[model samples]
Target: MFDSRHIQTFAEVVRTGSYAATARDLGYTQPAISQQMKALERAAGTPLFVRAGRGLRLTDAGQVLARHATGILSTIATAHGQLKAITRLESGRVRVCAFPAANATLLPATVARVAASHPGIRVELLEEEPPDSLRALREGRCDLALAFSAGHGGDAAEADGDSDEGLVEMPLLDDPLMVLLPADHALAGSSRAELGELEQERWIAGCRHCRGHFVAACAEAGFAPDIAFATDDNLAVQELVAAGAGIALVPGMTLPLLRHTGLVARPLAPAVGRRVSAFVLEGHETAPVTALLLRTLSEAAADMERAASGFPRSEA
Candidate 1:
């Protein structure tokens, strides 16, 4: 018989590629991790890993076990979640992760709705970018992930293809990217701003993904923007634009949360946008709390869609 703990240790070691790192993750000593691996090897009657230069490599048998380990772990998580749900959700917790803008706008409303109806169910929020959020979901650290795919031209299928096989993405909304400029700036009075119109302007970008999108849009417009500021905070991006630091391309979902006093936003020509989605592990979507939260999220997204309907769009 194989011990599930040993299986778990094997999977962690395989994932981190270091016994020491796995020990740190599982709160066990390095020697303890080695002992677990040895026990697992004896159960399988074959060596699983080969020592290679100060590191370790999985043998062929180890590779096969690693593949099965993923399924085993996922099944265990599903069972655990279902067991928790058997309490009628009178007392349970759902771990959720999302990017900043969603945390500010969408998630709060969804959480409010959940709290009103299921006060006994706790929803914990972890602020993480899409990559980290997805990682948390796969690693069993988070039950749900509110993530977005930027610069995907609003194609949900394309966005789904980009996610891991262990995750199932449910598209919620298409968030268009808009240009934010100082209220008295040259192009602020216009209902729209073409990418080419900002060729010589200084830019503020939020992240590497946002910067890449901005640079790509500029390239398509036949020029490169001089990016003057970089940050991951959308509110700070708006404040900087309001302060006349530089213009920025921001997602429409963040508009409701912005002060919008000293800045004006216009849609960009040849529009680029992000696809926002609710991601769950492959089989945990049926968990009661997860389902309720997802339903509330869908309702909140509908409200957002209605509110954003009046936003300006480029004429080109």
Candidate 2:
């Protein structure tokens, strides 16, 4: 019920034995210190100070309060410190959900940067496809979700209206889709190729969304893909492509992970790629963890996209 400022002034008065000195030390007028002392005495229901000529002396009540004030002031100072720490991003927890390829590529980089920079902010990652990840975000099981949308003018945020309200998106990177072909394939000699050019080749597709996008892109190019295989496993897809079973379209982020010998990755044109974005509730972007997560995620994806251009040709 008592003001911390008054308690602080009481302790200072007891320390200096003069209201003028307390005021000088605390940047208040002597009259203000005297008034505060009166108020403190009123709150305590007893006189806490007595005039001893040129200085002040403590009454028995004042002695008891001064004794307890030390601990009281210590507790108050500790509380103030904790409150201030909240203003700083010293600690926070962010639950993050990401798509499969993002989990393999961007999540590591994002978590690394977060650990190196904001070590106090804990990051939890969930590996899910865009649909499930976005669903979890809407369901409040996650603080941020990393998702993608197919070629829609390079901005997944607006492209994936996903038919949701109060969900905001931050566009992070555009990961161009790559064509994975066996080295012996007739088109492998070229560094780039068009989606339409491969219309006649047997196709390898992954995840429902990936297959749907590939088929839609093929339709746009005036052809239907002959998808002879459908598997979400990136390695299996690469193995099939390497064995000359069929060609595939995979994200640029997955390009570096392609390990099969005789597999060549070439950028598709008229360029096809997914837009990587961070999704959060409309106002949670300002949260410390979400803001930090968004910043780190953007930086990680940007770095990955920049490095994607330099993918080792010898391995691709």
Candidate No. with top TM-score? 2
lDDT of 2 by residue, 218-284 (tens): 9999998898999988999988988889998888898878777878888887888877889999999
Give the C-alpha miss distance for residue 240 in model 2, angstroms.
2.0
lDDT of each model, Cα atoms only? 0.83, 0.84
Which stretch of 10 consecutive residues in model 1 shows the poorest summed lDDT?
152-161
lDDT of 1 by residue, 1-316 (tens): 7888899999999989999999999999999999999999999999999999988999999999998998998898888887776557766788999988899989998989888988888999998876777877878889999877766322222332344676778888989888988888898788788989888899998766556666777887899889899999877887888888999998888777667577788888878788889999988888788888888899999888888897443210
What is the TM-score (0 to 1) of candidate 2?
0.73
Which stretches in model 2 have alpha-carbon errors above 4 Å?
A: 1-83, 152-161
TM-score for each candidate, following the candidate numbering: 0.68, 0.73
